[model samples]
Each structure stands twice: as structure tokens, then as C-alpha cells.
Target chain A: MSDALHDPGTGTPGPPATPVLSATGLTVRFGGRPALADVSLDFPRGRIVALIGPSGSGKTTLLRALCRMNELIPAAVTTGSVRFEGAELYAPEVDPAEVRRRIGVVLRESALFPGSIFHNVAFGPRASGFAGDLHALAEEVLAAVGLWAEVGGDLDLPASALSAGQRRRLCIARTLAVRPRVLLLDEPASALDPVAAARIESLIHSLAGDVAVVVATSDLRLAARVSDVTAHLDRGELVECGPTGTVFTNPRSKRTEAYLTGRIP
Target chain B: MTPLATRDLLGTACRLGAALTLTAAIALLGVLLVQALGVVDVGFLAGAPSRFASRAGVGPAIAGTLWLAVLTAALSFPVGIGAAVYFEEYAPRNRLAGLAGSALANMAGVPPVVFGVAGLALFVRGMGLGPTILAAGLTLAMLALPTVLVTSRTALREVPRGVRDAASALGATRWQVIRRQVLPAAGPGIVTGLTLALTRTVGAAAPLLVLGAPAFVTHAPRTPGDILTALPTQAFTWSTRTEADFAALAAGTAVTLLVLLLTVNLGALVLRRRLR
Candidate 1:
């Protein structure tokens, strides 16, 4: 097996505290065709883990499985345990909505609602029944994502008025408003220019000190640059995972080497 | 034929078909206007049906039609929109839901007279409402329900999946996501569909005829329990008469009906814009 290079000890981060989120023996199938097979990963608090792979290599499926987001698809069947703070997320008693609120996701698309800038940012907290002033909360999250200054504090401005880069940042800010313990971003910066992408990456770097972040991306360079740990997958199987430096410079498996060197799609 | 030549032919055919439809509609309108030129006036609008053609007025018929339209809308819209929301936003993708969806689609294509027959059995005779405005209104609402449900589902489906996913990802419950995002994004489309469905119901005559709407009534309906008389029935009664003057009065009633439908459509247009 290509997993001969998979050293379980090196693959897991030695965080001072228990992981904020982790997936064990996770297998996801859509219409009985496996998308991810027996994959395992950990996301400890205040750390960034980047999941990288070629197109349709189950990078997205893995990210969705981590937070129980795959349940939304009618044909998708996920088997395994995803734990948040040592509690099983897939248990019958667990509310998927509650799990989602605690673990926010920013999709590949901006996916802004048809509303003002403030509404988009305040949506999470308001939907969760925030008792505090929503305006103050909107301003706080917008500033956190570096959008307040650019928007000139016009909270009432329609979300569509913003540029593409600004809209992406607004999506991130929306997720942050919920104060999630873990953030899953699916190619959040893939649609942006290099400069805008750098801005997003820096924002993500700034956020790593508080929120555990998992980014799924095709951009190997991005995965190398932002992630503390990197996990690579190929054909629904995890080829290798370890510290970013080791995975990049000295991949243990030929598949990992082939993918990193652009030898395989 | 070559692919490019065939494409050009198809485009020309489509344009010709569209022009033909538009021309036919305008020509019909022109004919109605010419026939009703001298027959229609405030006096004609305010008078009741009579043995003397000049004395026949459509005031009571207009009122009945208005009442029927309002009742049909009140009965149909809430139920139809609610069913659509349940099917689109809440229902599981199971056999039952698939069966229900197909049932609604098939019902949308059912002849209006068929609904009238069912309505006669259910609301008219079975419910003991008699051939009153309430019975007619209930029948029309039934006729309109399937269209509204089908159109409403289409409108809800028009909303992008990304919007729902974005809201769901925020940890918003299904109800919250529907109320705050899905409904708002789909509001204009839903309103547009409702407007078209309502206009269709308002113009329907076969169902009313089958419901046994009175050919002539002495006064405008004062309540839902009052005897029913509508523009379509009045026009039908007049048009069926051998008198030339009654035929002219029928044309005038048709003109009035067209104007009323136009007004309703215009009002819905404004509502649609406001929703957007």
C-alpha cells in the first residue's frame, strides 16, 4: 500500500490541548460510489491544516465530512465519527444546525445573500438568536476581516456593490460573525487575483491564533505557504500527511512525490 | 439542409410565429373595440341585465366577478404557496413527495370544467353551499390551486442552491434559512407566478358555467352567500341571445373583462417590482 509512508504519529499534530475537531475512519459515498475512504484527520485549536489534491480527489468531500455538511446532499452517505471537543457530531441527539454554527464554512463561491453589507455579516449571529446589538456585531466582524475601512462603515450598502475580492472577504467575515471554534474554507481565494489572494491568505494567517482553520485547495503553493500541516489525497485515498516542510521537500510516497512534482493530475 | 441554413430557417420560423400571435391578439382587440364603440359607456356599465338591450348594465356582473377574483385569490394563494414551500424547502425526497409533485403537475393541465364538475360534487352539493358566490369562489380557487403550486415550486427552484448552502453553512436552521434567504430571493418570482395564475383564473368561464352561475341577477352580490353572476356568464348569456343588440352588449362585456384583467396584471407588475 502507498500508506507504508503514512506514519500516524507524524501525521497528527501534538497540540497542547485536545483537537477542536477530528474525523476518524470517515468514509463518504455519493450514490454508493466512494468519494473518500477511511480518511482520518485532526484540527486542533489555533492551528491551520491545509488539505490539497487534484480536482475531484475528495478534497471538498473531506472538508464537508469534517463538519457534517455532507448530510445536506440526499444521495450522500457518510460513515464514521466526527468529533467536536470529544463529542460525536454525527450522533442522533446532535443537531446538524448546531454543529454548523459552531463550525462555520466559507464555500468556494462568495454566496452572499440578497441584502445589505450589514445583513450578510450579521446573518449568522441573528439566525442563532443573538441578544446583543447586531449592528455592533456586524461592525466588529467587518473590521476583523479588514472590510470596514474599505466599506466606509456603510453597513446598509448592498452586498452586490462590493468588488469580487471584497465580496469574498465579506463571506469570511459572515462566517466569523458566528464565532465558530473551527473554520472550513473551500478555495476561498481561488477566484481572486494574486494580490487579492495574498490578502485573503494574510487574513487567514491572522485568524489562525484564535480559530482552527482547515483549507481545501488545489493551489499547492498556497497549501505550502499557509498551512502548519499538509495532507495530500489522490483517488479518494490519503497518500501522505505530515508537517508542511516534510510533505513538500521529502514526500514519503511516490504518489505524493508525483503529485507535488506535477507528474500526476 | 446545412446546419447554418437550418438554424437561420428555425430563427425565421420562430419570429414569424411570434408575429402571428401578436397580430392575432391585436386584431381581436381591435374587433372588440369597434363592436363595443357605441354600446359601452358609464350607463351601460351601471345598468343591470334587462329584456330591453339598451337598459342592460354590467354593474352587478362586474361586482360579482371582482368578488369571485378576491375570494379565489384568498383561498388559493396561501394554500398553494404553503404547499410549495413544504414541498420545496421541507419535504424529503421520497416516493410520497415524488407522487405529490407529479399529481400537482398533472392537475395543472386538467381542464377547468373538470374541476367544476368535482367542485359541484364537493363544494356545491356535498358542502350545501348551493350555487352562490362562495361555491363559485371555492370552485375557482380549486381550479387555480394546481397552477399556483406548480408555478410557485418553479419560482422557489429558481433560487440558486449556493444561497441555501451559504445560509445552511452559517448554522442557520432550515426554517431560518427559508425565511431569511430563500423566500426573499424568490419573492419576486413567486409574485410573478401568482399574478399569471390569478389572471388565468379570473379569465376562466367554463368552470363558472359548469357551476351553474345565474344568467341574470337583479342586484350585485352583497355577501359571499349571495347569488353569483359574473362577466363571463353575463357575456355568454348575451352572446347566446338572437338579438343583435345583446350581441353588441356581449362584446362590450368582453371589453370590460379585458380591461379588468389588464388592471389586475398591471397591479401585479407593480407588486413584483416592489418585491424585487
Candidate 2:
């Protein structure tokens, strides 16, 4: 089912082609109700792309579906193309475990294990048989997120002591430590104060030079600040896609304009 | 109404009621153990139970119960945890798996005596193994199966979904994720179930009787094929015997068994806290 649509979606015109991931006609239905219908977009390598939309506009659905997580939830069915590195992600017998490892996710809800913050960040690398010093890697990643300087001496402190914004960055550091080819973040900075939010935005910009980052958010202002290319989705369809500046400055669809003007959440 | 009076009404009543219930149950355990152990002799620890009512101890019986408890722990711990992992993390949430899961839990509630009969038919007689420690151990395993499984499953289920997700998200295979993340987080709970199951096996007599654990053995059975006597069966036998001395011997054995249970429960508790 996904094979036939890959050619057309993958070939869809985008500025200076060569996308790390090109999803096409990515349809997902939960008990015959389409949560995402024919949602196609491309994410170029080493670029920060944003998926912005209103509630129920298929932002998270598309993000999760791209990694083949629809199958994890009972009664969910995914069809069409979700290609990563030009490889069919939904191909039969392709291990979803492998797909997810290559495509790490920072969930909407922050979660840290019941252990020191060091264990939370080291969780990823340890799972992949990373025999290197986990504490060192944890320190490195935390330092990268500018957390080491603050919490460096207390590496053994419980994760429960961390503030909400710190937990968000720790989650990011955890994902980054795994060295995933693609990073999928769902509302990475939604709960943060302006200062923390700007730091996260800068982190996104810093991450763009190495990995393909796809940030799914309903916050148009955040999308404008973070992404190189922005795609606005409305009711499971890709309504508009362009450079972040062009799309927000002169949105083609009424839905995009409404979203930019705060008419839509 | 005064604020203090209002606060004291239902809340204090409910608190009193709950505390009384807990205290009553614990008191009941103490009374039963003390009564049952009264049959054991004072010198039983250093001596052995005998055919004559005048003789000293229930050493063989204590030994048999120890054997039974240890064997149950050894057999049920790994298998119960394996079953739990399969059901919680690996099994598809289909009708068949769900039914199997419920059936396993229901199996725990089966009568101990019935398990004894099955054990006799299958291991003691049908398998041609005759009365032996293996049959008795297998019988106890059947009886303890449900507690072990339910506890293990509950513990495994309590593990945060994010732990598994994070591991899989980081490219760990299902087995790897379970090994690295799920098992470590859930280990404390599994240990708890095992300790409870072990404690239960120490007191049960019906199934042990069916498996041919003798009422009394002057000498401890050396191997699985040898006939054995468990502490509970010996305590019951001694209490009914026409002798007052055997009663003291049974009391001592009862005390010893209670201590064993306490030790295990405390150890599991400590391990659980450490893990946490």
C-alpha cells in the first residue's frame, strides 16, 4: 500500500531537494475515523522543520505514525508512505524497534525513571550496549544542554528534584545521547518560561547542523522562531509548506492565516 | 458543631475500624502459630522427632518444611517472573492472551487439597516416581503458582511504560529493553511475590499430604525418592497423638517456621526498599 505512493510523495517538489525523510499520503485511521488523511511532507537532512496546526490537526498523529507507533495502539491502522533515508518505514517485517531507535522521540509528557537524573539521560545509550562510561556521557549531554554547570556536582540527585524546564532539556539530552539520525519532538518547549523557551529554540537551531529535527507544535510563534521550513496542517491535510518566514508572512491557506493570527489554537 | 467534634466523627471511627481489623488479623496469626507450635519439644533443635510420645524433637519435619520452602522458591521465582514478563510486555492484548492471564490468576485460588490430589495422580503415582521430595515440591509449586504469578504480574505491570518506550526508542530490541529497563525496575516487586509464596508453602499440609509427605519421620529424607515429613503435617500429627511431650516438640517447630517466614518477609522488604 505504501509502495505505490512513495514515488509521487518522495518526488513532490521542495526547495533544493534531498530530504532525510519524505512521507507521502501518510494515512492513519482509528476504527475507520481518519486521524490523519494523506498527510505528506518532506524533512531535509540537517534542517529544523516544524509541523504547526490546531488541536486535532494531525500533528502528533503524523509524528507518531511516521515511526510506526500506530500499531502499538490497538485498533489503529496506518497506510501510505513514511520513508526514512529513502527506505520504506512501513515495509513488512521491518522491525519497528529498529525504526524507533533511529528516530528518537521527546514526548509531550516529560518522563524520567525513578533514579538519579544521570540514569535518565544514560537510559538510551545503555539500551544500545554502549559500554562507554555512562556517567561521562550523561555529564557530557547535560553539559551540552547547559545543565551540567548547574547540576554537575549533584549527578546522583533524584530526577524528581528537577524543575519542569530542566526535565524537558534532560529529556532532549537523553535523546541526543542515543545519537539518533532523526529527532521527533512533540511540544518540546510548551511548558517553559520565555527564557527557557528561547534556550530550547537556540538548542533546536544548534541541533539542525547535525540531525534532521521535526518539531510538532501548535504554537505558531515557536515554530517561526525555530524552524527553517514550516508546514501547516489542518484536519490531517498539509495545507501549506514553505520557508518559515514565507509561510507565516504570507500564508496561502485561510487555515494557515487563521493559525498565524491566533484564530486557531 | 465544633470543628474538632466534626473531624472526630466518621474519620476517627473509620481509622479505628481499619486499625482494629489489621491488629485482629495479626493477632490471629500469632495465636495460631503459638498454639500449633506448642506440640514441638524444647530440645527439638538439637535432637529429632521420635515414634514414642516421650521422645524429643521434630527435626526431620522442620528440615522437610525447609526443603519444601526452598524448593518452591527455586522453582516458582524464575518461572513466575518469566510468565509475568510475557503477559505484561510481550503478550498481545488479544482475547486469548487475556483469557490465559485471568485463568492463571484464578488457578491461584484453587484448593490446596485439590492440588494435592492432582500432584498424587500425576507425580506420585502416574509418573511412577512414588512418594518423594520431588513430588512434594511439585505439589507445593502447584499450590503456590497463583500467588507467585499474580504478584509478579502486578509488579511487572507497575513498571512505567516510558522505561520500555525509551529503551525501544533508543533501538533496544524487545528482549534487550526488558533485560535492561523492565526487569531492573520490576525486580523488587517480583522478589516480594516470591517471598510471600515461599511463606505460604511453609504452612500448607493438604497438598503435601497428598504428595505423600508422611505425618512423622524419625529420620530426614536424603533425596527426592525418600519419604519425608513436613513441619505442618508433623505438628498436626503430634497434636492429635496421645502424648503431651510431642505437643511441646510441635510448638518448637511452629515457632521455627514462623521465624523463617518473618526472615523472608523482612529480607524481601529490605531488598524492595533498596531497589526503590
Candidate 3:
């Protein structure tokens, strides 16, 4: 329930103007159709930001654009600037591999690699050029996610053999292996039961302050409970931005209020 | 009509069709066998093929065919599978790669006789290797290359992308992904392609003629540079003989060739079963 779990690094805070991540007019067009239109936001370190909106609200598109993952899809055209740690992420010399390593992503589908749990957790660190004991690192990260006991003994088993909830936790553990500065998660607990969802929430709570955590979910209860800041998107637009309690308890926009009261998905 | 009666009628018709098809295949095999037995003596197979080979034994021809086939498979098998993996797994899904891949696949179906002329131009006269088993082997490699390449590509393509993505998501480079996940998963298909290409090369004669497989080798060719004598050329020579014994030799060569084909096919079957 506290941010003590992660080491957020040298308490040297940036200028009130120095953002951990800042985007400027990000636009992604797919076959002349606007998937994301001139999206821009600034995320600071030690923050838990919840991206909440109806399905197809371009939250995922925005997330993909941030990582430049949309370029992998043909007919995708992007025009934007994403600066992470004040370095241009889309610069010609900037390697996407490095970007992915520094900024871990967790998809709703749980991108669990088809291998043993040890290998799955070791993936990012290995890809990012981790030279130390990978097995120890995997064990440490799995323990951080409170899954070490369940998967520790069976670190050699296929990932597909895991239960759905365990696979989701393992996915979180896999991302944590890299020790990323910025974490992007989409619907991390939409598919889970209340108990599993609470565990994920606790993990997110523990991750805050050490890393910038961004979660996109339709669960208003989740958005209200865990996040510090809430950004509402509707039809590819950032409709509202404010403190989570303020946004949910006393929404400024009619749409946000309607959404908060279950008038919309 | 009663359900059982309709089922019985359908079953009866299916059985009749299957029986007829099986009988036709068996009869064809039987005819080939009878011709082989009637013309060739058991002595033809057992005796020193090199001594009576020009007239009776087919050791030289058998050796030639095996040499050419083995050399061709050895050269083409790795290259074909590598190309297939590159095209299917590593190549970007763009227009240029698509066009080039299709062009290569189409090249496989071109006539073997044409390949013979190509081999003559590329590996024979052009390279001035001049009728050596090496030249013939390379020609045979070129002839089988397209078939192996296409089959291997198809096999690699059939592998689920999920396995690849899963492996890659876990620190695997593109080549490592292909080696560990894609190739193993698609291995059976590769073996099937290899067997097919090897069989096709064994059955080919026109290319060996262009590449100049020797007709009267007195000794077994252990080296690629040695002039080789393959079964088809020996069979051709024997079939031209005025004596009945030479005709028997040709039939015996055919039987030996058939057995070799069956052996390769069985090996491929075992590999495919192991994959499952």
C-alpha cells in the first residue's frame, strides 16, 4: 500500500518544468483514418496515472504511439515527438530496442513468452544487455510480484501451463526484469476476478514513486482506488485531466460524470 | 430410407472405390516388378557389378546415381532450408520480398531438362569443370534446389507465428528465433521437402547426360572429381544390347533404383513421426 517497494533513485527531482516523459502533438493515421489525433501529455516521475475511457477511445493507440510500436503495422503513418528522459525516442539514431528496454509495456492479453518462467522473467534484462546473474534477477522480480513461490519451483515449465491469473502476474514480473523507468499497462486486471485485481492494484501501488506507472483501464473503481491522476479520453481525445478523486467525485465534464455513473462503458 | 441402410450403401460405394484404386496401384507396381524379375537374373544383382557392369552388373551406374543424388542433396538441402527460413521468417512483409519469393517458387517447377542445359552452361563449360562428378553433382544440386527451397519455404510458412513471437519476446534474435523455434517446429515439413527433392533428382537422367556422367567407368568414383557412371546411362546402354542378358541388367538396375527410392522415403517418414 506504500511506494517503499521500488527504489525511485537519487531523490534529485527535476525542475518543476523537467518532465520524465513529454509528448508533443502525437498523431497516428492508419489508411487515412485518424487512429490518434495530435495527442499530447506530460508524465512526471513517482506518479500513478490512470488512462480511463470507453473502449476504442484511442487509449491503446496513444500507448502504441508513445512506444512507436504502431510503425510495425503497415499503412500506419505517425507524426509526433516523444521525449523520454529528455532524449528523442523517435530520432534516427535512437534504437527502438533501447526504448523498449527502458520503458516496459504490459498488454491486457499478458504477453507471456512461450518458455519457462525463469526465461520469461529474464527476457527483458537479457535483451537489454543484462550481464549479471539472470536467474537471481528473475527470482528477485518474481518475488517482487509475490509470485516467486508459485513459479519458483517450476521455473522450467511452459508458460502456457500457468493459470490465467498466474500468467498475468508473470507478465508483470517479466516487465519488471528490465527495471524500466516508465511502465505502460493496458487493462491489467479487466480479465481478472476481484481478488486478483486487488493484487495487481497492490503491485501498482508498490511500483509508484520508483517508476512512472501508466495504466489504461475501463474499471472506474480501479481508476478511483489506485491512481493519483486520472486522464479521461473519448473518441481519440483527452477529455479531462485532474486528480483521481476530483475527477470521479466531482467530474467537471458532463461526459465524465455520465461515464462515472455508468451511463457509458 | 432407414439411416442404417443409407449408411451401408455409402460405405459399400466407398469400399468399392478404395478397392479399385488400390488394385490399380498394385497392378502397376506388379508390372514393373515382373518386368524386372523376368529380364534380370539374381546373378545380375549378386555378381561383381563392375566386372559384368558394362554388360551385366550395374555397380558403376548405382554408384553414379547415389553420388549425384547425395551430392545434390548435400549442397541444396542446407541452402534451400536457409533460404526458406530467410524468406518466411526474416524477410520483411513488403512488396519486393513477396515478388522475389514468388519468382523463386516458380523457378522450381521448370523442366529438369532445362536445368540440365543450365548446369552445362554454369557448372560445366562455363566453369570448365568438364564432365567430372563434381560438375554433375552441382548440376543436380541446381536442379533440386528450387524444389527443396519451395517445400522448405512452405513448411516454414506453416509454422504458427505465435511460437515465433513467444520466443522473440524472450530475448531471441531473429536468427536464434528461426533456429530454436521456427525450424524445430517446422522440421518435419523440411524433411518431407528434402525427401521429395532427393527422389526427384534420383529419377532424373537428362541432366546427368548434359553434365556428362561417364558410361564406362571401370572403378568406383570415391571423389567428386572422378568421372561417374549413373544407373540411367547404364540402363540405356544395356537396353541397346542385342543380347537378352543386357536387357536383364537394365531391369535389375530399375529394381535397385526403386528400392533406393523406397528407403529414402521411409527415412523421411521416420523423421516426420519423431516430430509429432
Candidate number of the best lDDT: 1
lDDT of each residue in B64-86, candidate 1, tens digit only: 99999999999999999999999
Candidate topping DockQ: 1
Best-to-worst order by TM-score is 1, 2, 3
TM-score of chain B of 3: 0.85
Q: Using alpha carbons, what is the TM-score of model 2?
A: 0.90
Worst 10 residues of 2 chain B by lDDT: B37-46
lDDT for each residue of candidate 2 in B1-276, tens digit (9 for 90 to 100): 899898889798999999999999899677666665545445666457667655557677767777787777778777887888888888888999999999999998888899889989998999977777778887888788788999989988888877666566666777887887788888898887888888887688778777776665777766766676787887677677666566655666667777768888898899988877
How much of the true contact map at the interface does candidate 3 reproduce, as a fraction?
0.13
Listed per candidate, the RMSD to the true structure in angstroms reads: 5.4, 4.3, 5.2
What is candidate 1's TM-score against the reference? 0.93
lDDT of 1 by residue, A104-222 (tens): 88888647898799889888898888889888888888998899999899999999999888999999999999988789999978978998999999999999968899999999999
Report the lDDT of model 1 for residue A3: 30
Please give the TM-score of chain B in predicted model 1: 0.95
> Per lDDT, what order, best first?
1, 2, 3
- Which segments of model 1 are wrong by more than 4 Å? A1-15, B1-19
Where in model 3 is the C-alpha error above 4 Å? A1-18, A108-115, A190-199, A262-265, B1-17, B24-63, B89-96, B159-188, B231-276
Clashing pairs in 3: B39-B248
